[model samples]
Target: MRNCWFATPGIARPMSIRCWSSRWRRMPMASDRKLTAFFLGFAARHKWRFLLSVLAMPIYAYLVAEAPNVMRRAIDDGIMAGDRAATIRHSLVYLGCMVGGALGLVAQHWFMQSGGIRTLTHMREAVMRHILGLGRAEYDKRPLGVYVSRSTSDVEAIGETMTAGLTNLIADTLLIVFIFVNMVAIDRKLGLMTLVIVPVVVVVVDIFRRILRPLYDRIRTVNGTLTSQINEVLGMHGVIRSFHLQGAFNRLFREDNDEYRDTNIKAVSYDAAVFSILEGLSFVAIGGVLLYIAVRATGTEKALQLGAVVAFIQWLQMLFPPLKQMGARFAILQSALAAVSKLETVMQIPLPVDEGTKSPENLNLTVRDLTFAYNKEQPVLKNVALEVPAGKSLAVVGPTGSGKSTLIRLIVRQFDLNPGGGEILLGGTDLREILREDLRKKIVLIPQEPSIFEETVRYNISLDRPEVTMERIESICRKIRAHDFIQHLPHGYDTVIAGEGANLSMGQRQLIAMARALATDAQILIFDEATANIDTETERLIQEALDYVMATRTTILIAHRLSTIRDADQILVLNHGEIMERGTHDALMTRPGLYRRMYELQRHAIPDQ
Candidate 1:
């Protein structure tokens, strides 16, 4: 089979057929291709508006070009000849051209802005949808703030480029073209003399672009890093303070902040230097035009007419502002291109492949020769095999890093197993053959550290499920013995929990997590050290709740405390990724194996409850 690969910013590897498979791969750096492809695709979606914008540009250019000609006629045929009527007629024509040019400009701006906005909106929506579709494993690999930066600042830059930068760029290019055409139309020799500055300006702008591209890339990278650091610090503020590492975090943040500031300064300095050079070049071009006009007027028998000279000067003036402003416009273009590259890189991440068509009808669980490794070299679960009948509780006990949590992760498809390593079955159907959503609905894992959103208790319990009514929620809470404490809260089910349930005690958070699990009404429940973090008092409160929740469902409990698993239907002792012993409470005690030894050690380590 062909290996599947997805790319993010740093890592690159073929996606393995595991539960936590990557869908994205690194896209090659093809800035030009990415930019051109995006605009072309955007234009196809808004064809009429884009075409209309293009059409208005030449018309606007023509109207603008007509103004200088009318002025030349008024000065030569009317004013110099002492004919007021001719002057008035030419002046009226100039006014009419100016008005028409102004209207055309409005139309151009409207069409371009409209098309750009629509295109960017669609792009933003598509990026957001892709981000949402990414698996938990992707989020685990990248900082939340990096993704936020991509969605906000980076996206805004691209939008600005498409709308304002693009509009002005097109308008200026057309204006320059028409101005050059008219300058030559009036006096070919003089126009050619003036056009000599065009190449000089083009070369300068090109030099600036080459110098600034890498600087802007640096700015964007630093900004993203700074944002990521800030987000991480804020998210873990509690831990940082508890450990008294505030000073360390401050130093780290200061370094990142300073780096961001310095990069931006460098980019701005380059922009300023380019702007100053272009402005100086503009003046030089104007002076050269004047020198040419002075020589032609003084040395020739039939001197250049005053009217033609003035009109040509006006055209020359119009030409240089666009060239002068080109540096700033190019800066925007570069930033936007960088944003596009980033967006394309993210969009290439592959979504999870959900090809399973089977759904389990019962909750009987079986694991056969299940082996896994994070690095493929050192196996974590080595040929593990176990079975749990429907509605039976299985307790898994092991020392730390002995594949206890790894086994649970494999069953939940957190990471994919190697082909031929093993197979897991639910209700006699292969686990890989069951749809993810269907599998999740049937089995729920209440982790040791449950995530509680900053929302009402009701919302957290229901998890936005519209069908989970208040009565059902309260009933579940009551069964889990969480209702009394919830009722004592300020708003009962409506009470809003703080971030990660910081306002609630450890036991309260675990109880809420239990309530959530029970709310799902899943057929199988896996408790991965759910009561490990709480105090003895909290564990007592939770044990009552756990007994009721595990009574009907098939349960998988991972516990260090032997007391917690005393009533378990079966206990499997694991050590170094292999099953060391297996039996019930009495049978395991008689064996004098890993389980019996562990039980005796814990019993002696602490007094019985």
Candidate 2:
């Protein structure tokens, strides 16, 4: 199969050695460098273009600053001075500057937006790879929707900051500076007087930030929670409808929706107040500047020129909007930062550490004192141990909560072994010493709930592996007795499977899974109740297929049906995480132990078997 780093969400395989390499190790956490260094890395890849885009901002700002100055000259040196030709020339120059500024915007957006898209795409892929690389134990810690939000909405939030928010913020800051410089050049007294409001504007922005930061963070959190709840409910759609839980789910969604609404209202109220204050301050600065001009008119110094006064008013008009938008821009920044804070937590989740390089030559499986627990106080598997010799089959029969599935998971290294816990070995080398990719090539696990993608039957079976040809797939399917049913489908092997195989029966999914596993030609095979919840006729066909497949492979079978493992070389009865009995099936049945008792109970419960 063509192993993909970006695998289907439900389909998983062992990770490659590259997953542990320095490529991912170099990613900086938000707490360590606060996303500055991280985002800079993306820009660094296209450094020249990013730099040029930023340079365009200052040029655009300069043009904007010069436009009003051009107007000032046209009014004073042309109109007031009765020079119509000079006025027309200055007016034409103003038009050229505006046009140049417009072109600068287009160029800036093209460069900046392209880089932003590249950054967002890389971010999404990294987040998904990291999430997929996480141990099964880590998956147990959060909902699927949280990861979805991190990769989709949260990443887009950061992208918005990069493309729309950050670029404009830089332009606005530069324009503000240039406008203030022009104000001073026009008249130092009035310019310094206008500067008096700088401290006040800074104070207002600071307070607004202090109030809105937490609100933005809270909104993001609530939004993620609501998304999670919706996903959870949707996944349980069948169960919800069967149980008539519409009203209950409605109430839950309503509560979250109300909370989201309330939080947004609070943010908007404060945002509106801050924005209005900035607008009011701009007019106040203009009023204060006019008052200064009036007072100075009575002085001995030359009277303020009508053109300069008009230009000063125009500068305020240009200046205050960017300042007012500064708050809205900061709001976008806060949203992005909130997203960064959330995604950083995800990135910080340590990937499963594997430093193994060894490859096994034999498939001998061994376990000594194997123990595990999801909770510290509650051990799921106590000091249990077993072995399956090369080319031998070991059947494990146990009731629910007997650690049967956990044992299978441990064999595949789904969850990391606990410290001081027992170890597993293959070919006399510790299982941990084998590279995960190499180990995956040696083993095939068929779980009860097989993951079926929305792809053709052939693709599902071969997984696009170059070696698993069409002839081989058909041969394997025929051996497993899946070909008969598959051929009856709309397009035979080419028929597309629905999501989770809803179009196929449980038996057919298992058959396809068996075909997939056989195509791998793995040395070690594990069946974790693969035949459970299937029809008797289908179960019999699977057993026949298993009989053929298990002949030359090291096999471990966990079964609730005692009859399925009757011909196994050995059987182990496990209870409460401990093996209660171990022997050949006939030998176990001959005794009055847990194995014999369970076998008898199943024999009577399902009499046909």
Candidate 3:
């Protein structure tokens, strides 16, 4: 029957719901232990708040439990005896209990919510730090949306458990226990009879829980995928529009969205079913107690009094709400646990290794027997060798996918090399032996596409670096020939850049990247086709800047435009990750080699402009 019911939506993967339930039972206990430790860490940080919340629960429960008994005393001793004073006394006691209980509830919630905010803030910071620390390879394993979802939505889910679900679970349990004890104290036989439905309610809750656990997991998983799809689509909206792929992306998004909706509907169906059964059973318990009173009260020897009956009725009313709330809170707890598991997986990605402690003393660069591949079977670069003496320049030219970028990544230590693959050295120190922080300060890569932030031009150029003052920034901009254009902006260097440099021309954006690179005053400068996207006039200005900047700096220039590298001290014509030819521009062009062919082709293509 469970299998048939779960089959209606057909969302569960790998197996039917029955199979999933059986497998879930066999899941290892270690995961539960890990999750327990996860919550324990949360408690350890905010122990006082959690303790206060727990301590207030029993106080609130006791007051709530005694309220109905107070009403019973008023009914039997005052209303039945026609004494207004007794009724007024009991009424006053009831009011006091209500006020006291409200305060306890308020205290419990306030402490829990405040603690949750602090915990959530710390948790988000940890996740962001982890994401930033991840290696370039780890980032390739998942989409940006997955990280965003985990950091934002998943963290919030766990926060909800801390604030509302866990707090309510404890409070409701205490409330139920106190209500049961008071009922039994009033009339043991009636109290025992009312509980006949408890076993059935437990069974129903268990079955629905099994049904919803996997469903909730599915819903959360689909939400992440849907979010990733949305981010990808939005981030590539221009490309999609250029390729007329709106309909294709729309269909893909619809599929993920529909799957999300279907899983949620299944979860809601089972959730509603649980609540319906709980409500029905509550009514049954009440009706059974009333019937028992009627049957037993007919005798001359009364089995129950009117006061007890009234109190019992009132207690039943109080009991079922918490009963119903337990069901809702359980759903929230389950969702939180699912989020915990997802976040745990993300946090387990290996952090980048940065144990290098040595610093280089010079800018001389050397690559020896350099070989690499994203995977073992398909090598991108093999047995590559190159060198650039301090204060000298080297130019690398190759067709796309000839491992030009791979070589650059290797030189910058973006990917760690295998033991026998290759070695890159700066001065006499191996690249792997140099501290990453120090290495970043000395080596900078300016790519064809510039990254501009939504800040003033001054911030974009200086990047808030302490060393790059306003004077230094102006000097660098002037060297890069960008000072004049920047001064013409509405606010000069203080003008705020639009997102992705929408307000700036392609040439202007590239010029800003150049100015930033120049301001660094680094020993070695790497320009990877920096002028590829700029106009001819901007390229000319950038070339002039490059001449000045490269004169004293050890530079690695990777370019497609052969004319730009004509004056490079040594030019290497790279093909298929190997140095096919190496010589000065005039020497290489004089021979019938790859460099001469490429130079001639570009020279003819440009039409002497």
Candidate 4:
């Protein structure tokens, strides 16, 4: 029955949501749908406030619309008819209407502005939370500059413009409609004449919208580039200065700045042209109305009253600006929509890995015939098969890009392997069925680069497990040669490792990372050349500590320096993502292979082992 339900008519097959890098072509409406849903749902919740804003919009227009009517009546029955009582009574009504309209206009501005500000705050926070929700795996796929752009500029654009658009669109549209209706009611032929500029205004604005949208997108692209460049220069300030490239870098910075300026200037120039054209047409239409009124006034029997002419001019002045503002609002909407679409596209990309349903305690991992590739034609790791015997060590060795690090990642399931690529045996079961969180707790891998937050050393090592005792922390630190460094610090473990532990040496940082992994106390452990960047003395110290810490623990070691793996129970040589050779050190030396060659070359780098 369940299968039948899934197979029913009009139901789509549950295709795997492929990773962005994996797909050859882009997905359809992927980002547009997500962005539309988020924005629409948000607006829907404030529907009542929105309607209030909408209703308030035309209040100002109502005043302008009523202006001409009041003038017509004051002329026909009060002023021109030569009756003092009628003139005074009608004059008072006109004064009252002006005062009330002015006050309502002020109130209208207050509510629209308040609502825009309030909604923007909510949207900014939502974008921030969504970013924080992603795991380390998801973050690694995106560029640092792109992420920065999304948070600072992109969210701000989406939030501010969307709310501003909602407000102005409501108000401007209402004002224009009310004015058009009144103009037609008073004099249908003249009202029709007034709209001649509208089609021209709309056409000019449509061109402006199309041209300006791409510019905003380009501006954002350049913004990401500028951010990335700044980050790279700042991150590698030491290297840049050492290489004496300050002058060269400054030139590059100037070039980027100039490009950004040129792009913005061009967009502004074109938009200015659009405004100029619209403004000129508005003046022409009003001039025509004034000329026609003047000619008709000289010979007309009800020669237009003095007050009536003044109020008609005010109504004309009031009408054109809101029309102009409507165009500007449309421009903002176009630009903001472009940014939202880009941001939404990235967010819609499915996370490559998902957590397993089984409990962590009951889970283990298995890998058999495992193969994967960044590109389909050439596998980064191919037909690689291995096992982590329960409570033992398996060391992997090879040159760079030979799939050593990729092996560790695969064990953690950071990337998907082909269905028949291989099987990872966890205890007695295949890893495919194990619960992900549970599996992670059972086996944890530490990498070459040590990750530290701007936090205390104790917090870095302890992670989220608050139950770890100080004694256990001290033991791990001592074993990794990190205890001495901690003691040397001004506040010991309490000292804050700000700037991601920039104060610590590379060796000390790696030791701290090892301590973090040790704190987990998982059944299986994998170390990926953690000692590569440290000096020989520090490497030896850590190696000694690792021997003690790794005793009887199921471990996978990826070593670049052959000396570290001398005591490894089993060593596997991976070449081009395939296991080319495998055996103990003495056994592998007896055979002529990739492992033997690498061993001979590294003997100078790993003496007395």
Full-model lDDT for every candidate? 0.79, 0.81, 0.80, 0.69
Q: TM-score of each candidate?
A: 0.84, 0.84, 0.86, 0.78
- Alpha-carbon RMSD, each predicted model: 8.7, 8.7, 6.1, 10.4
lDDT of 1 by residue, 502-594 (tens): 899988998988888878868889999987887778778888888987796889999978878888899998899999888898998888688
Across 1-609, the per-residue lDDT of candidate 3 in tens digits comes to 133231212112121232222123232345977975765675578878878888888888889888989988888888887899998999899899888887888888888888888878877887889999998778978999899989998898788777867877788799889888998888887777667656676677668777777886677578778887888988999999999999999998899899988887777788668667777787887888888788777866566767888889888877766654455566567667777777777888889889899999787898899888888877888888888998889999988888887888878877888679989999889998999988888998887788999999999999999989999999888877899999999999999999999999987998898788778867788888876777677778778878877786888889878888888999988888788999899899889999999988988898754
Clashing residue pair totals per candidate (backbone < 3 A): 11, 1, 0, 17
State, as a TM-score between 0 and 1, how close model 1 is to the true structure: 0.84
lDDT computed for candidate 4: 0.69
TM-score order of candidates, best first? 3, 1, 2, 4
Off by over 4 Å in 3: 1-29, 82-86, 199-285, 300-303
Which scores higher on TM-score, 1 or 4?
1
Clash pairs, model 3 backbone? none
Best by TM-score: 3
